[model samples]
Target: MAQDPRALLAKADKQASSARGGFSLFGGKQDKLEIAADLYTQAANAFRVQKLGREAGQTLEKAAAIQQEINEPDDAANSFVEAYKAYRKDDPSSAARVLEKAIQHYTLRGNFRRAATHQQNLAELLELEIGDIPKAVAAYEIAGDWFQSDNAEALANKVFLKVADLAALEGMYPKAIERYEGVARSSAGNNLMKWSMKDYFLKAGICHLASRDKIAFKKALDSYVELDPSFPSMREFQLLNDMLEADDGGDAEAFADKIFLYDQMSKLDKWKTTMLLRVKSSTTAPKPPLLGCIEEDDDDGLA
Candidate 1:
């Protein structure tokens, strides 16, 4: 005769309750913890056999938690990953939560590579599944920091770029600029990254212009010149300088036409094209008046 599924569940529950009682009596002794983990695993197996997926995942998570308390972090992480897999089919949010637990366990165990990998996974889940761009950015930044701490500069740079891109998409221009500048500064010291530094400087300058900070834009240009004195001879540098001068002269239309002509003659890359458009838009707007209200009224009553 086949055993009843409910009977198996009841037996598993009894074992779990007994294990809990042992834990209370023994105060997390190794034997008690081992017993609790075993009971939880058994309960999870019984739940799975009965097609109670949610219950099975929960029970497996409980087993994982017990492993954590017992200082078996590797076991805890593995069990949490298993629980995440179990929950993924029916409840993606729950699966993400379990994966977070797994990441925490991996981080606590000083397995930074695994932790960073899982953090990236969680970020992707938040972005794709939850549609939380801010939280996803934060997760990616944390992952990047961890990768940097592990001396994985390539991986760290890739993750940081994601953060910068998302920040820009979210309209946080200052943050995007800062991240771009940081990556640019880091890349400047590397011969392999020589070609990318100019692009980074260009991006940072473009962001400064987008933020409507002419002072910052000028400073960024100066910094670029410092980095590469030959920049002034470059067509990009000459174009931007001419645009600034045109804006100052209140002839933004002339600059826009000039850019259009230049673009027709030589197609610009996406970054340069977008940046020039931003510059044109900036110049179209009139500058704000420099002087505010006077403290004292004159004889003409001007204040």
Candidate 2:
């Protein structure tokens, strides 16, 4: 006599459950794709026992598709996730596949933010990985932008400093300076951050000078002095003195006077003394020299 279909179905279901249970606890370390395939196969077998041909067919199809992904996956991490989710309730394999898909998708993006997230997940998967610092720096910078947009200046500044440190490590002083400036500028508008400005301005000035940005150097120096009178940097001191004396806009007569004063001081103290006395004895206030007159004087001297 033929067995009752319901009893046969119950027996098949029990066997399927046993297979799935063994598969789930068997290995803590297995390929995500392989485990997912096994679970799907078990689910299909159970559905077939109940004569649910449609569900069985669907489960088998999902298994094959997921297996193919492990072989030659593309940019469809999202799709993989969806498939994994749909079958995960009955399968631990599916859950693992979902997490793997998340990593794959993020890694494919190549953007600092995305790569950072993926790299973090990947790091958890392995003990030792190379080039982590560079990735961390890039991620921190990207996170800085996100934090800035969300009005988290303190966090942003922290990340900005990390970027500067990385740039310095790469021997990219100019790039490092730019990153430092971002930190300074973000702090500038707030009174609480005012104390930081003194150091920030001085550092910016030094970087500007090194980069040959005379205009930026001058401006930064001006800010630095305003914040603190005793700012050190013999280079800035000399530059400031020359700039003040050159207020006549590079006039040859003014330059000659500078040279003359130096020469007199070097020759004899009495000569400088006499020159100072004469300068103080002028009967009338001197008029400002016209810029055009300096050019004409230059032309006449050349001719």
Candidate 3:
């Protein structure tokens, strides 16, 4: 027979209360705390089975607190992560909060890989759950740096690309270009990533255009080819060159035609679609101001 969740919760609560209250003749405070933490974890799992995420999360937090009190750092961190998992669906705010606690624990212990993983997770939580773009970018950047520190170049580059994507969305074009260009330059040496070079460079070019800087945008193209000799041969280079001419004349149609051709060959992702649209919008010349009160001769009838 399944144990009643309410009964399990009550039993866990009583055990935790007794552990926190005082020492006992049967055992020391640490022993009592261990038992209480175990019971709390058990109850938390039962609550999870019942889909009581909030209750499970809170109960798991109690276990984590007791684990910390008993100087079980690893257990405490694990409990905190478990609590975050439980709270994610029902209470994402609490989930992010506790997940950060676990991240801090891993960071303090010099666990860069774990820190990087959870930091990336935290960044997604901030990005997707909270809709906080700036904080999410910051967290993602930290995770990328940590991954780099851990010698995980592939993971670091992936996270850095995400930072670039979000930064471009926020209209921070220079920041986005820097990240994209940086990754492109770094990835140039890797044979596996060579094909992706044009993409990164293309994104950086679009971001430069999105910033509406024609001169710098033109210069960036030459710089990209220099960074990787193969870049000029790619279709991306031709597309950028086409857009540059269109931008000079403020010809929206010309710019769009170039994008259309490029899209047919290599489909643009959401980020590219957004950036290209920005570039397309900026290609139109601003309307001349209305001329008011223009002097005119009275029918010019030799008067």
TM-score, structure 3 vs. true: 0.91
Q: lDDT tens string, model 3, 105-220? A: 99999999999999999899889888899999999999999999999999999999999999999998898998999899889889998789888888898888889887888789
In candidate 3, residue 28 scores what lDDT? 79
Residue 270, model 3, lDDT: 58
lDDT of 2 by residue, 188-230 (tens): 6677875665545544543453344566666766655655565
Rank order by TM-score, top first?
3, 1, 2
Question: Model 3, poorest ten-residue lDDT window?
Answer: 289-298
Which candidate number has the best TM-score?
3
Error of 3 at 171 (Å): 0.8
Evaluate model 3: give its lDDT: 0.84
Residue 159's C-alpha lDDT in candidate 1?
87
Task: Check candidate 2 and list the clashing pairs.
Answer: none
Error of 2 at 31 (Å): 20
Clashing pairs in 1: none
Candidate 1 lDDT, 1-303, residue by residue in tens: 434535644655565566566435544556666776776777777766667767778878878877877788788788888777677656768978999988987887798998998898888878877888999999999999999999988788888878876776666778878888778777777888756766666666666766778888888888888877767777667666766677677675666655655565555554455555555556655422210011011123321
What count of clashes does model 2 give? Answer: 0
Query: Cα RMSD (Å) per model?
Result: 11.5, 21.7, 10.6
Mark the regions of model 2 whose C-alpha exceeds 4 Å error after superposition. Answer: 1-136, 209-215, 223-303
